[model samples]
Target: MSKIFHPVSEQEALAELPRLRQRLTAKARHAHQYRGTEGKSLMAQAKRALRWHQLFVSINRRACQ
Candidate 1:
């Protein structure tokens, strides 16, 4: 599937920050609540997603500023 790209204005980024933060927190919590091999795999994925969201949030904050 092809993805569409668009610019996000400062206002939009600022607005999205809170929701992103919430998702980041949830991901962190999920990453911690697991055990065994399957849990390890799932936690790895969650950590990766958390890192991506963190980078996005930081970039958004910088752009907004």
Candidate 2:
């Protein structure tokens, strides 16, 4: 099966950003319709960044080992 691939480094982590933000914004807009507070959305973005960083770190570590 084919796996994830990115032509550029910044584009890699930003790949899901648009879709994730859309989904999150919709949910937040529907849930509370709050103004300027992006709790869930920000958390989602942070988690995505953390996961991507962890994945790269793991790949590098394994390659070194």
RMSD of each: 5.4, 7.6
lDDT of 2 at 34: 40
lDDT for 7 (candidate 2): 29
Q: Pull out the clashing pairs in model 2.
A: none
lDDT of each: 0.62, 0.55
The per-residue C-alpha lDDT of model 2 at residue 40 equals 62
Q: After superposition, how far is residue 10 of candidate 1 from its true place, in Å?
A: 0.5
- Candidate 2 displacement at residue 4 in angstroms: 14
| Per-residue alpha-carbon lDDT of candidate 2 for residues 24-59, written as tens digits (9 for 90 to 100) | 566555644544657566656656866676576455
- Top-scoring candidate (lDDT): 1
lDDT of 1 by residue, 1-65 (tens): 01222345557766876786677667656765665576667657766876776566566555545
Q: Cα deviation in Å at residue 38, candidate 2?
A: 2.2
Q: In model 1, what are the clashing residue pairs, if there are any?
A: none
Give the clash count for model 2. 0
Q: Residue 28 deviation, candidate 2, in Å?
A: 16
